[model samples]
Target: DPSHIAGKREYLYEISQKAFDMGMEGLMIESHYNPSLALSDANQQLTPADLSKLLDKLVIRYQYANNPEFENQLELLRNRIDSIDSELLEILASRAEIVRQIGKYKKEHNVTALQINRWSQLMENRIKLGEKLNLSEVLIKTFFQLIHEDSVRMQTEIMNS
Candidate 1:
């Protein structure tokens, strides 16, 4: 991400701090004895002294806290997340089954698996619904595109079989 930083050296420390806060165990920081004389990525390359100072300033957090109440609340929230994930997997399986049935129907009717107009409509509807649910449009579009691709692949397989 040195290129993305675009000579803003301060951002590197901020990003490293954020990564540490996000539970990253280690960071591969570029350093040199004389960064000003470095051939590549000189802007991002911190001198050894600066690197040491940056490392000292960074606060690494442990994954688990020692507080029992905090741990209990975290466990409860994690359990809820696990339950939701299970439900999501079940829903995806059901959707895949329905897609399989649709594939069979398409094969019987001699219809194409990919209908451009249908895909366009589906994307529009799904994007709007996702936005209403406070989800990012890009995330919804990418997620649905992946699902649609898999659905099309399934139908194509059925057609070939």
Candidate 2:
């Protein structure tokens, strides 16, 4: 983070303030008696007095303020997220069922469950679609890999049985 901050003390102060305002419990700011002579991360290390000033400027925001309007809005947003999560679970369940059927078909036909070419093609298409939807490639790949692993495991079990 210091490398990213690149000796910008003002940016660090702003970021720290933002984090505090976002209801972070605590922060670990590096302070030294003399920052210029500090052995490591000299660029990021603030003098004790400077650190104290930064701390004083930080406004701590409470997670649960006694404001009815804010609480109500927060509750609404949380409810929406819960609804989306429920729908996501339902979709995953349906996908799992379809995968099980595919596993059965593969078992009956003596076909391998872990088809590398198909997986590679699926990943390429999925990454493209994910990028279009503004999703990270890492997230898409990891999610699909987990699903594929489960599908392979299920198919292997069916074949063994």
Candidate 3:
């Protein structure tokens, strides 16, 4: 598919460079002793000599941890990300706990999980807040729908159990 270009060789080189840029190990290139005489897909085949030249032109960089400065910066950033991820999980868990309690209360009152008016109110209020926070309405809707679905499933399980 990548070979579907004017210059197949150049396409391969470009693809190789992009792969390297995007933290890929390497590209799987088809090499032939003689490209023109190749039996199958000759157009997409690279001569060994050409492959060697392309390899030479490429600058393969080490992983981020190779340099101490880079490693330190990456570690700091990753640690911050880890902390943020932990906080996100904690928030979700807290929400789940509340949903669990709600399930119990609804059961006690002999109410079903599908509280349409309550769901609509929540969606409307949260969507407004999400808009104020500069979030896309579509994104907010999707996220809340997923959370609502999660709550419904968990509540159903709790109710039945």
Which candidate should be chosen as best, given TM-score against the real structure? Answer: 1
Segments in model 2 whose C-alpha atoms lie over 4 Å from true places:
1-24, 36-44, 49-59
lDDT of 3 by residue, 1-161 (tens): 33444246657887777778778886777789998898876887789998889889887866565688988998899999999999999999999999999999888888998899999999999999999999999999999999999999989888888
The TM-scores of all predictions, comma-separated, are 0.78, 0.72, 0.55
For model 3, the local distance difference test gives 0.85
Off by over 4 Å in 3: 1-68
Candidate lDDT values, in order: 0.87, 0.84, 0.85
Question: For model 2, which pairs clash?
Answer: none
Which scores greater on TM-score, model 2 or model 3?
A: 2
lDDT of 1 by residue, 15-132 (tens): 8888878887778778889988988877778888888898899888888899999999999999999999999999999999999999999999999999999999999999999999
Please count the clashing residue pairs in each candidate, in the order shown. 0, 0, 0
RMSD of each: 3.4, 4.2, 6.2
True-vs-predicted CA distance for residue 133, candidate 2, Å: 1.8
Ranking by TM-score: 1, 2, 3
User: RMSD of candidate 1 to the true fold?
Assistant: 3.4
Worst 10 residues of 2 by lDDT: 1-10
Looking at model 1, residue 143 earns an lDDT score of: 94
